[model samples]
Target: MKNLKLIVFALLLTFCTTSINAQTADEIITKYIKNIGGAEKLKALKGIKMNMVTNYGGMELPVEMVQLAGGKQYVKLNMQGKEITQMASDGKTLWSTNFMTMSPEKSDAENTENALQSNADFPDAMLDYKAKGYTAEFVGKETKEGTECLKVKFTKKPIKVDGVQTDDVSYYYFETENFLPIATEIEIKAGPMKGKKSNSTMSDYQEVEGIFFPFAINMGGQDLKIKKITLNPVINEKDFAFPAIAAVTAEPAKK
Candidate 1:
């Protein structure tokens, strides 16, 4: 009888702990969303355009990024009078410019699909995450950059990697005092950085038309300083389309 009672007690303890963790996660997310201009304002956002700059090899490169609702986005970099499309997705197709070839290349079907699914969480993934079939767990507290933070593990629908379904997960660290997400860590699943952790930190948040944005972002070791942010910017679909390659004109035999 005592053994059964202990078993029941253990089960109850586990349930309570889980309930508390889930509640904490939701509360944190709710506070964060409210801090970042509320849910309605965020949902009403049509698109955003950012003018930024990053230093590469002691050279300052101008960067422009545009992201629209429903998964349309692109990032461009200007270097030495040449503009390069770093990456882009028109909500259906994924593509990027090849530096060596200076030509656009489309991503494989699987990667394109994965990108669309991931970008669908735009504006903010934690907003109505449950409805999007995502889960957020309060994973406890940690210190980042000398500030105490509450860590949350966010998991989304699986994405295909090399034709195999893989877990899509990221960890966000929210400042304990302000509830602002200060850092994010995600695992690199492909390329030379496969199996390594990619870390990004945000700071110097400023408001634009009542919505807060991080003006300074550090991804890996590269820093992007946002100069301006335009909300609801008009976008042209043609900008996201893959450029057509000009056909070579056949020359008549030299007379």
Candidate 2:
């Protein structure tokens, strides 16, 4: 009888601890969403256009990124009076400009699918994350960059890495005082940095059209400083489509 009582107590304690942890995570997320202009305002966001600059090879290059609500986006880089379409995707087809040839090339099947899946998180991933079949857990408090933050382990839909499905997990560190995400870390699944972790730090947050956005983003050791942000900017869909290279014509030979 004593053993049975102890077992029941253990089970109840486990359930209660789990419930408390889930509640804590949800509470933190709720506060974060509210602090960043609430869910309604975030959902009302249809598109975003950001003008940024990054230093590449000791030269500051102008970069423009525009993303629409339904996973349509493109990034254009200006280099020495030349416009380069680094990457563009119209939700289905993923393509990028070949720098050497200055021609558009479509990405492979695996990459395209992965890009599509990543872009599915419009506005923000934490908003309606549960509906997207994602799980969030409170991993306790941790200090990041001299600021105490609440860590949340977020697991989203599985993604294919080298033909094998792998967990798409990320750790978000939010400021405990303001409930704003300051940094995020995710393990790289492919490429030369396969086993390494990628970290993005955000700062200089400013409100734009009722929503807050980080004006300074450090991603993959590159700092992207935002000069301007336009919400719901009018855009042409053709910009995201693969470009048609003009055929060169040979001059007629004189007899």
Candidate 3:
């Protein structure tokens, strides 16, 4: 009977451990959602509009960035009161323009694939991720820069854009105490740095419209500081149009 008890106890312990792990994952995600101001508030979020000052070489440019709920993005750089460069994505296609080119061009096969893996949802892409065809796994706790973090391995739904399949995999480390994302590791699939990993750490979080957002973001050597945030502002589709098309549509009649 002692042997039987031991087997039963082992089974019970196994079940408990599994249950605890599952609960830990669930609670982390749930609390994270709540701490960021509930799921419905985030789901109804339309977009985020922010302005920042970026310095390239000796020129300081004012960058206006707008992000939509569907993953579309519009960014315009103003230099000396004139627009110089602009890029936009309509959640389907990504296009850009440079001051030298002066023409908005569609992304090539390589860039198109990169844009495909971009988060096209509001707030955290991992929120309600199962419904969006992605899966996230809890990787337990780890220390980052001397701070304990709950590491989670997150994957994007494998996508094929333009016959190219991107490795849609990344990992996010959330603060164990607050559950806010502290860092991310993503693989660079193309370009000179192809097949390498890039790490980005997020901090300086600010709350906007009941949601916590990282106001200061740093990746690689690029530093982005949010100067302003407009939540759910009325945005015109024309704002996202390629400047060439937008310019032609805005011209006065040549009577």
RMSD of each: 1.3, 1.9, 5.5
* Residues 67-174, model 2: lDDT tens digits: 998899999999998888899999889999888988889999999998899888988899999999998899999999899999999999999999999999999999
* Residue lDDT tens for model 3, 1-255: 999999999999989877776667667778888888889888888888888876677776688988887767888888678785478877777788856867778877666656645646555686787788876667789897577998877787665534676648887888977898888888876568878889888888889878888877778756777788888877888776554554455778789
Cα lDDT tens digits, model 1, 1-255, are 999999999999999999999999999999999998999999999999999999999999999999999899999999998888999998888999888988899988998999898789888888899999999899999998889999999999999989999999999999987799999999998889999999999999899998899999999989999999999999889778777789999999998
Q: Which residue runs does candidate 1 get wrong by more than 4 Å?
A: 249-255
Best by TM-score: 1
Q: Candidate 3: which stretches are off by over 4 Å?
A: 1-23, 113-119, 244-255
| Reference-based TM-score of each model | 0.96, 0.93, 0.80
Model 2 bad stretches (over 4 Å): 1-4, 246-255
Better of 1 and 2 by TM-score: 1
Query: Which pairs of residues collide in model 3?
Result: none
For each of the candidates, give the backbone clash count.
Answer: 0, 0, 0
